[model samples]
Target: MKMASFSSYYGSLFLLSLFSSFITIALGGTFNTDFDNLFGEERVDIKDDGNSMTLTMDEYSGSGIVSKNEYLYGRFDMKIKLVPGNSAGTVTAYYLSSIGSQHDEIDIEFLGNLTGDPYLLSTNVYADGIGGREVQFYLWFDPTEDYHTYSIDWNPDRIIILVDNIPIRVMLNRQSIGVPFPTKRPMRVYTTLWNGDSWATRWGEVKLDLSNAPFVAGFKNFNANACIAKQGTSCKGFNGGKNKGLDIESKRKLQKILSKWVVYDYCADLRRYAHDGLPYECRKENLLQFE
Candidate 1:
């Protein structure tokens, strides 16, 4: 028993070392309280459903949104359990924002749900990098029957994406843009379970299985610690920024809720951040101008 206890102790110490050269807690907790401001309590969640939700240009009201005003530099982490089915599209959960002409996005998308031992988990980014660009990586995991924590750490100069404390990809602050690096605005957080039908593939096929349409996914336990940019981070931000979901709402109610969204103007802060594709609809009643 003593030997077993000793092994556990040392194993934990090894993990704490992995977080930072300055950290010493030993095996950082999976999703702790320190990551709250960005994600909030019970931030990400998805529920299994027999309903089919498709968000077109007009009807778009799905998913929850968060802000990055709390902290300018810190980590954003979320733990999720995926919904299953052949119709299941790419599952996305990440933090990003667009204010002014600058845009930044990061994604952890499980592209396919083919029955198998290993599902394909991919990461993509866009920044002032090589092409101001699109870079991707593949991760194989048992997504059909397990929950995993998808995390990202953001410092002033760089951003790091992690899986179980394992750093998967990094984006540099000053990328290779012809001009200055692109992203400079404070971003918002968005988590979604979308069905990417236009380019969705199931066994080398792009067609979706309508019989099993509307697969469910859940996002819960978010940790967001945002600070101002004076401090720096070691991870990189990526491409893939947009909103996806189904809109099943009446016009009057849509206007009621969408008003909160328009209350804060992106025109001054951001040129554009997702405005078209959502599950909720907007009308004259939902329109409000901000000073």
Candidate 2:
């Protein structure tokens, strides 16, 4: 894959935003494999005439999918039904990442738990290969029972993770605080289900039960509105300009979720950052201001 330069990424975003002024783009639709152009077909099971895809994991192998086109910045959304029952050691990961050693990435990893325990939603961001910022939360609803919409809204200013349209977490651009933001590289959307027994459950306490092997995860309703940079030019139909920061209601929703369901936060993990205290962006004042 050819790596996109910082100037090209930002330039495409600017052009896409400008193009949106004269064109009205539709939103909220199904993703067709023919149009989306996905790779890693052999790694996943496709159904519904390619409208839906499933990833399965067993003792022998796991499955995954990746987008063929790279996107600069946009709102990426998908509906996923996670593995049910005692799913310890299983991890369903959906993320976007740039290629190379110093790549930038945004992640949404679902850590499986015992039947009655809630799934842990682990979120992290990496820029220029420096990423230890991990925040974990427990969903209010049973994730394995039904499909839920998970979305990532990434722009030049910030990144927001939403569940069913409600904001759950927000990571602002903290470049001034020495935090590297992902603005230079283009990333492709990817999803996979694999065994993560070593550190996936209770710090590896729960091991994978192969009796429950072939655990499956369903994915559909793939929706993305963002700037697509190809060959140093902005692709047409890139309509993500309208996506913006959180509103007052969204902030309230995020506050409610954090207060009730957030299990772990990098901002509060003093021990993990004992050597450097907390990152400047994770300071109490900065965190409170964002909240």
Expressed as tens digits, the lDDT of each residue in 233-268 for candidate 2 is 653334334445667888889889989988998888
lDDT of 1 by residue, 1-291 (tens): 999999999999986565444321112212222222222223333223311111111013224344423233456766766655443344444555444433555556656555442344555444433222222344445554666788766554556666665555444443333323324544555555544655544434554455554355555556565432323532222221111111333223333433432222222322232554321111333323210
Lowest summed lDDT across 10 adjacent residues in model 1 is found at 50-59
Instruction: Name the lDDT of candidate 1.
Output: 0.43
User: For this target, which candidate reaches the highest TM-score against the unseen true structure?
Assistant: 2
Q: Estimate each model's TM-score.
A: 0.50, 0.85
Q: Which residue pairs show collisions in model 2?
A: none
lDDT of 2: 0.81
Model 2 CA lDDT for position 203: 93
